[model samples]
Target: MLDSNETIVAIASPTTPAMRGIVRMSGQSVVPILEAVGIKSSQAKRAQVIQSRIDLGTPLGKLDIAVSLWPTSQSYTGQPSAELHTIGSAPVLQSIVNVLTTAGARAARPGEFTMRAFLAGRLDLPQAEAVLGVIEAEQRGSLEHALNQLAGNLSRPLEQMRSEMLDLLADVEAGLDFVDEDIEFISDEALVERLSVIHAAVDKTRQSMESRGGNRSRAIVAFRGNPNAGKSHLINALVGREVAIVADVAGTTRDVVSVETTLDGHAVQWVDTAGIESRAQHDPLFEITAASQAHALRASQNADVRIWCVDACHDDLAAQRRYFETHDGSSKRSSIDIWVATKSDLIDSTQRQPDWMYTSVITGDGVDRLRDRVSQFVASHDKEEVGSIMGTAARCSGSLAHAATCIETAIRFVQQGDGHEFVASELRVAVECLGEVTGAVYTDDILDRVFGRFCIGK
Candidate 1:
């Protein structure tokens, strides 16, 4: 862990030419820096715009700056903190940062200020991740989600669930420790019932989280089809630009080509995958193509939406069904599936499939409808997903997923009326996983994943 005892400083505000700029500091020695720089004030939270000499010992230059102090330890980082305010200038801010670093204060790393808050019990792991979400949010829906997380919307429920799980864990472990006593603090039936409730709650939370997150944060919409089906052209038409390779050859795209755009203020990531074939011949080139298709299929399975494209001029129901079976994730994911027959200009209107969207890149038929459909799908998902899915970070979701698996295993053991030790072990895994989400239980790796990319001075 980075040393929090030593003072750390960073320019809190943008270093652009503006009316004011801020050089913030957090540590035990924060107040002393202000004192050494001739800031004498006992009042906290008040911005004292008094002129003071910023001493660097060696002559870089002298400047007058305003200072504010949080002289107590109950500040943001649970340490004495201060912010030096001056006219907004990059060189001026850089000079102040240099001076602070020179005077026993080191530069704070990305997310260090927020990480310090997390370490000091000010914010939990989910909340810490939410800080980044707020920073990276591109739309209002995402911004609202981040602000909700910051207000403890997700953390509060997770905390309750963790507290209950901790109790159950204690009971299970205690029973194991005193196996000979035949004392049942929590009955097998009761344990089974409680575990079931938690399992459902966690499952509900995970699903809701996945949906809200997938929809709000750049939801991946993948286009899967046979070779020469005009998938690239379809994407280009939708995005109003040439982003992918369009060609007449089979196996043109041996990799997933993705582009990001916004629809109705919701960020959408559109992916055009390599054309997948059902029957495979034993050739090196075919194997490579198959491998690329497999990777794209996995991505498609997780994508928020899937656009399964087929040639409009061709008639092959079996091939279409096979493609749908492999690429469509309607049952497994909180997602939408759209079957599209591309190159519609060559086909008669009577030849169109009843429910399938038929589009032609050359004639521009159905392109606007397809784009509007996709946008409506996204907007609807954003509104409806909150009921069944919540969007937490990937790390937290993975932990929740694993915890759910462990809980399921424990419930089975309890129902089987055997293997108390095995049941206890499963409970431990579930609770520990749950605890990691809230930072009640964490490793250095978990900390790194959560806070590593945070901007300095956050």
Candidate 2:
């Protein structure tokens, strides 16, 4: 929207003292700008690299640079584009940018390059956000999620859903237009089924977005169970250090102990909570046990994943069941529930529970398996929710929720024998809502919110 016909330029590479740097330019005047800056061979460009020198004079006389050109209109921005590769000297790059600006190119705004790509249909709204995700990704998991979004993992399905909705809307409107013909465009059962599918899809997407809103920054794994169940030792083993104090005494960990580390390319916080036990209210230590229990329950409630540690040698199946039943209502349940039989080395293989992971910090029996299960659970939390649109999830959640509501309403109308006109109207609203997700119905404000976070020269 910002004068696409005019040329824009920026230094594409990091402003560091390195062996190479890049100045990127795009628009109709890319070739002319190069020619004006003394690159004569740019005029004959057809997606070729041209070697040239710029006569800066004075402090820096002539410097050699290579210019890679996409002279045709099939480039990243769907316009003529080029990049000047040279030494990664900040001053030198700034000077080259200044020279290009003086030769008829304007300095690019933040996220302007990707914004242009979005405007030119090279990338959708979700994909544009993924570009930023890739830029700001701190770990490999985040990067992979962003890369998948950029590759249309989120957009493709929404696009397909939109297409199907459009077909349904057309049929509804057609039925309304020919009401007197007594023709059935879609059966009530079929319409309800289709609408339900759309509603389910939209709801799933909305829930996924909500899940990301709470834990997008990192995953919380809480270690909890009866005192002296080896919870502290397990935490230390997983973190590869003694982050939590371990002891044979029950209730030794009277507070929440947490440590941050990377597991399977994801930022994970390991939380060790106090052992769960009951003390008489009249006991002098009642208040202490009560406070520790409260903290443990709070940590368990807040955790994204929970690992229940049971003493393999002492706790029987009945005790494990009672432990779970007593603490089930303590907090909001974790998305993943893991049972761990700790101190496995103290017992034989026949003592292991089939459904519980067995581990022993003394011998390191099932620590790696438990760690893998936690990592896999965290990674696949919302994978099916439109390919886990990591970065765009929060942004599009409202629209997706609204779309689901609209579909639900339309389905009710169809079931209640409402006129086709009403059904068509609701479907129209749902279609527009989906369009907003993919930039097919975006406003300038949405564009600003999406592209504003991008760095210049993307």
How badly does each model clash, as a count of residue pairs?
9, 0
Worst 10 residues of 2 by lDDT: 381-390
Per-residue alpha-carbon lDDT of candidate 2 for residues 1-458, written as tens digits (9 for 90 to 100): 57878899999999979999999999999888889989866345478888989866678878999988998788998889998999999999999998999999999988988988998899999999989877876555556677878999889989988999999999888888888997988888998999899789888877866776545446789988888999999999988998998777888999899999888766688999998888898999999999988888888887778899888887575577566857757553325678888899998898667777889998989999988998886665434222335448767888898899899999999899988788889999999999999999999889888888889988
The local lDDT score (0 to 100) that residue 291 gets in candidate 1 is: 83
lDDT per residue for candidate 1 within 296-413, as digits (tens), equals 8777876877888888877774577575775544432356678888888887888777878989988889999998998887876576434222434566789899999999999998
After superposing candidate 2, which stretches have Cα over 4 Å from the reference?
42-45, 216-391
Estimate the TM-score of every prediction: 0.61, 0.67
Computed on alpha carbons, the lDDT of every model, listed in order, comes to 0.80, 0.84
Error of 2 at 456 (Å): 1.4
